[model samples]
Target: MLAMSSNPDSPRVLICDDDAEIREGLVQVFERAGFTAYAAPDVAAMERTLAAKGADLIVMDLMMPGEDGLSATKRLSGKGAPPIIMLSALGDDADRIVGLEIGADDYLAKPCNPRELVARARAVLRRGKDADQPAKSDSVRFAGFRLDVARRELHDPDGVVMPLSAGEFRLLRAFVERPQRVLSREQLLDYAFDNDSEVFDRAVDVQVSRLRKKLERPGIEVIRTVRGEGYLFAVKPTS
Candidate 1:
């Protein structure tokens, strides 16, 4: 459930689109919906705005005059930037798949319904809000992957502590605390990031894979697929 703003303030949205008309229209739509919106017509402005301050969400266009949204999305993935909803003229599944692959949380075709856009925004944010929570502790060590919340770190038998991005830490923590529970993608996103994204379940899978690689246990047995279900932390955790 979305919470009422403490002071009736609006969310801050950053809009990056080469199309001036589209950018302005989205700004108007979000503003009318009680969001403070900022627009950037190109990638350069997008960078500046993103670096200047964090935003609640970023609305970006796929095709641009300069570097495309796909490339920008890659950079955002590396930096773990704000949750994004991409606007693309391309309606192909491959394009959408690529967007998801690179970490664009949501993808919307151009000329979408304003009402739907707002709903998407809220839904994404609702997920984001769920991330603020930390899962209950059950103490897990699978193969060689170990998560210790008191220290906020994961370690191998070699004592090498892998660095965790905030999101990675939370996701891994959730699994460690609930080993063997086949948590759904939506559940993991909410667990790891405070319920803030419409991020694809695949993104969660990718993050888990990345964590698994870092842990590097035999057969990569830490995280296992349950098919039809989401994923499970394979080892039974202890106190």
Candidate 2:
């Protein structure tokens, strides 16, 4: 049996790929796995479908005919965007890093195992829902930024909301929860991902890099690399 999310309802997923066979196959795979799956031929169709009926997550192909997956990924990941799992034929570290950098919650090389894909989808959806659940009125403040833990929101000093993926939110949570403490790659992974997800050390590095780009500013080094030790959250947060 496929893994299920904590919510009883099956999550909705949209697969955007140019290949008809591949798209249809993935749609069947997700449906059999108990997801409400939809298929789109390209970014345009994906946008149209989403406009009509939003999905909980997206499974996008990296190399499409019109607006490649990277661009679409960037456009789709923002303050209200659904989680995305990118599928790419190019199975290089650089390619995966780019996808992660652009806010894809997960990355799977093309021709991936359907079972693994289902597992990844479940993991991402679970994390996203967890992040959205509001806790008590608790917020963390540091370096002119505010992290509303309950609402899973990060806001700039100007009160503008910044977009964050589930993985990014977890990493930042680990940092803010333990300011000035250096956490090893293993520890960061432990904090950021559930046991069901198989993420490597290099993947952690890519996530930190992307998080830095989002939070870093002049004289505001939120996260610092501790050379061989690991990474340290430089700013001290106040509750």
Candidate 3:
């Protein structure tokens, strides 16, 4: 079942949870916060709502009777899908990391403050809106690699396309845009993630490591780590 609001101009948020009370409560909260909110009882209904109405963001339960949130989020991971925030009873750091690595834009434990969830949603929406602004170029070239800004794709010098996760794409884009400059973890986080995201410096390091592996060559070092500082994009990029 789906309940929707009439405000077409407001941001659209889809809340999916098996618990009736939780779903309805979130719907009310988002609506009161000036969003055109929709509610779905399960993953199936969530998909239907997304296909029919579209959404600026998705707030999904980590556990459900049929398709779980992790599986569904992995399935939906891509360039154009709406950002997702996973709500789970498992509040451990490992669980949150798993959710993020699987493609959720953010994760929150259940029984959280509704206001915090709303704030996180707004932060994610702001990041999405910023990304949608027109770029000086559709593609950027650096160190025998090409990043397709519009499509969020990366290509090696050999012209083979390298697959990147959403986080990896954002991290790489940040690096390529500011080549030859040392960027602290905080700075990278500001460039690559929502300002209010709970991601830590370790998450930034992990993303940089993953991007480094993809950009690695036999003897060519593209990203250089400065001792006691941060990482630097060793080459200049041209758009």
lDDT of each: 0.70, 0.83, 0.85
Better of 1 and 3 by lDDT: 3
As a whole number from 0 to 100, the lDDT of residue 145 in candidate 3 is 88
lDDT of 3 by residue, 57-110 (tens): 999899998999999998886646788999999998888878887778888998
All candidates' TM-scores?
Answer: 0.72, 0.88, 0.89
Which pairs clash inside model 2? Answer: none
Show pairs that collide, candidate 3. Answer: none
Rate residue 115 of model 3 by lDDT: 99
Q: Residue 197 CA error for candidate 1 (Å)?
A: 13
> Candidate 2: where are CA atoms >4 Å away?
1-8, 135-137, 195-198
Tens digits of per-residue lDDT for model 1, 12-94? 78888887777788888888888878888887888787687557888888889889888887777535467778888886666
lDDT of 2 by residue, 15-35 (tens): 899998888888888888988
TM-score of predicted structure 2 = 0.88
